[model samples]
Every structure is written in structure tokens, then in C-alpha cells.
Target: MSTLDQDLASQIERLRAEGCEIIRSEKVSGASRDGRGELEIVLQFLRSGDELVVARLDRLGRDTRDVLNIIHECESRGAFVTVLDPHVTTRGEMGHVILTVLGMVAQMERRFIKERQKDGIERAKASGRYLGGKRRIDRHVVRELLAQGQSVAAAARTLGCSRMQIYRIIGEAPPAV
Candidate 1:
């Protein structure tokens, strides 16, 4: 198994040993809830006595508001959430307080990470070691295709880019045709 899969398996085994009966996992980023189908399923399936457990608070979300919203949702449904790493649960008032603090810390940490990354990029650029992202489509090829009388849509299709990119390359607004 891949390293991520192996880590997940180990986490599952630990939770199982901890008496967790139902477990769900997803490899998607926890930055937002936009594409977390497994999390949604668990939230929807929660009952009065059900407990939602995650390996860590960050596993729930990186945004403080999103994490609090999730905890609130679970509480409103009479379900509890547990974080294994810090061993906190919504079974008591203290847990809520601690979770709120932890959520804020996680959000702050994300911001700090972004700041550090920006600083590193600045340093690399100053040293002439950082080039921007690799080019995905050749501007010359796009121009040649358009010069051959291809439609904006057709040129975009041929170059695997957007029609707007083709329009930009040709420096003209889209024709009414």
C-alpha cells in the first residue's frame, strides 16, 4: 500500500481497537467541506447517540469556522465528535471549549504556513531560483492554430486550453460567428 493508505489503515486499526464501530475516511483536503462526501455521509447518518471520530481536529477542517460549524451540526443532531490525537470529545462542556481553542489554533497555523511559504518563494525568486509555474500550453502553437483560420473554440480544443486563452493570444474579442 502507499504511505497514505498505510497510515489510514493504521489509524483505522487504532480506532477499531478503541471500540469505534463505524469508521469512514477520505483522502481529500480538509481545507473545506466542498468535496468531502464521506464526511457528509457520516454527518447525515449520525443519530442521537452516535459519535463522530477523527484522527485529529485538523482532519475535520483547516478553517476554524468550518470546524465549529461541523461540531455544532453534530451537537444539534444529538451526536458527539471525538478527536483521537488530543483525545477530546463533545461529551462535556470542557470539550467544547478545548475544541474551539484547537480550531482557532489550526486556522492560525494554516495562515502561518501560507505566510512562510510566501516568504520562501520570495527568497527563491530573489536568488533567481524560482521560476513561476510551468507553462501548460504553447502560445506559439495557439497563434499558429488561430492563424490557420481555426475558430476560438476549435483552437482552444486543439491546444487543450480555454477559448478565452485563445482569444487573449489573438488579442481580439470573440467573433459573433
Candidate 2:
């Protein structure tokens, strides 16, 4: 089995140990070119006919639209998702309402955080106090490793950044024109 398959199998095994009945599953690689190789595996697990079990809502989706779509899909299929850590369980009418409200709040929080970060960045730029983040790992070294047939995962581990960062750096090089 491939690494991805193994990882998913482990996740299913863990969920089953916790008494969840996983009906279906989809292994979603994270969005964006840079985020490739970052797995966001999703499973539709259930405890009973009316109760769906999820380790976390973020495991369901990252964005509000995606989360709502998943929730609606489960509801249409007569299933309600419950998160373990937050202790949020959605069973019926109240469940739907609570999920909707929580989705709205989470979206709002994301927007607010983005705005605040943008404001801080702008302020720091005006004051000339922000030098941006630490310099990224050398792209020349990255290219050397890739040319030597080293995998992105190995390169990322050596460079001390995520696989996503390695992809991003590789993507930014000037294309032959």
C-alpha cells in the first residue's frame, strides 16, 4: 500500500477503535499548489443512525462553504455530525441551527483575523520595523537536491520548512522564456 493508503487505514482503524462507523471516506490533499502533499483526509463516520462522529469539525473542512456543504449533505442523508473534543453534537433542528451559527462565527473570525494581520503588516511597513520573515531556505540548494532526484519530503526535512514551502520556492523560479 502507498503511504497515503497506509495513513488513511490508520485513521480508519483509530476511528473504529473509538466506536465510530465510517460509512465512506475521501482522502483530500490540501488546496493550493503549495499545499500539495498535505493531506486533509475526510471520513463520514457515524455512531448511530442519527449521530455522526467526527474528531473535529476542521477535519470536515477548512472553509465555511465547504463545511456547510458537508453538514448539509450529512443532514440530507439523515446523519448528524458530532465533534469529540469540543463536545458539540448535532442531532436535529437544534443541531442544524447550531452548526449554521458556528459556521458563521468561524467565518467571521477568519475575516477579522485576516484584517487585523493586514493592518499590522501595513503599520509595520510604515514604521520600517518589519523585515518580513526569516529568509527562506536557499532555492539553489533546493534545485540541486531536486536535480539529484531527492524527493520534496526529504528536501523539506533537510531545509526545516514544510513540504508546502519547498513547493512554493520551486514554483517561484523564473520559467524559461
Candidate 3:
């Protein structure tokens, strides 16, 4: 098995020891940095009296507001969130408060990451290492496509992009796609 599978196995073991039963597991392939998996599994699948388990609280979200919203949604449905690492469960007032603080810290950490990325980008731009990113699709090509009797939506599809992107490249407002 892959290392990721092994780690997940260990986390599941810990949760199982806490009297938690696994119903379904989803391995989200998307960046899922936005808690899509958590939302889909916890909000959509689980019912009242169900518990959503995660290896870590941060795994649920990257922002404090998002984390709180998810927890609130679960609580409203009578479902609880259980974290395995530090073994915190949102079944109590104290745990909810602690998770709130941790969520804020996670949000702060995310802000720091974005700030550091922006600084690095600025440095790279100054050193000419970045050229504002290259456009794989050309504006002239979009105009040409439009000139060829193609609709804005068609041009966007041909370019493997969105109509808004095509409109931006073509420098004009587009009809609804």
C-alpha cells in the first residue's frame, strides 16, 4: 500500500478505538483545499447522530470562517466532528471553543502562506523571473475565431476556456454563452 493509505489506516484505527464507525470514505482527488470533500461527506451523506471524523482539524479547512461554518452545519444537523490527532470532539462546549481558536490559527497560517507567496512572486517579478505568466491562448486567435463567424461561446470552447476569458481577450462584452 501507498504511504498515504498507511497513514489513513492508522488514523482510522485511532478513530475506531474511540467507538467511531466508518460508513464511507472519500478520497478527493481535487486540491480540495476548500473542504469540498468534507462538505460532501459530512453535510450530504451523514444524518443526525452521525459523526464526521478527520485525522486533523486543519484537514477540514484552511480558513477559520469556513471551518466554523462547517462545524456549525454539522452541529445543526446533530452531527459531530471528531479529530483524531489530538482527539478532540465537537460534542462539548469546551471542544467547540478550542476548535474555534485552532481554526483562527489555521486561518492565520494560511494568510502567512499567501503573504509569503506574494512576496516571492514580487521578488521573481523584479528579477524578471516572472513575466506575469504566459498566455497559452492568444488574443489574436480569439479575435480571429470571432471574425470567422464563431460565437463568443464557440470561440471560448475552441480555446478550451471560458466565454469571460474570451471576452477579456477580445476586449468586448459578450452575449450570454
What is the TM-score of each predicted model, taking all chains together?
Answer: 0.76, 0.52, 0.72
TM-score of model 3 (CA atoms):
0.72
lDDT at 74, model 2: 64
- The alpha-carbon deviation from the true structure for residue 166 of candidate 3, after best TM-score superposition, in angstroms, is 0.2
lDDT per residue as tens, model 3, 1-177: 998788678767776777776544455432234536545655876679888887777767767887888788888888999877667789888999889888888778877988999999999999989878788788778878988999999998888999888877777565366
Worst 10 residues of 3 by lDDT: 26-35
Clashing pairs in 2: none
- Candidate 3 stretches with Cα past 4 Å from truth are 1-41, 134-136, 172-177
Provide the global lDDT of candidate 3 against the true structure: 0.77
**What do the candidate models score in CA lDDT, each in turn?**
0.89, 0.66, 0.77
Candidate 1 stretches with Cα past 4 Å from truth are: 1-3, 134-177
lDDT of 1 by residue, 88-131 (tens): 99999999999999999999999999999999999999999999
Q: What is the lDDT for 96 in model 3?
A: 94
Residue 141, model 1: Cα distance from true site in angstroms: 8.1
Which candidate number maximizes lDDT? 1
- RMSD of each predicted structure: 5.2, 8.9, 5.9
| Residue 40 in candidate 1, Cα distance off native in Å | 1.5
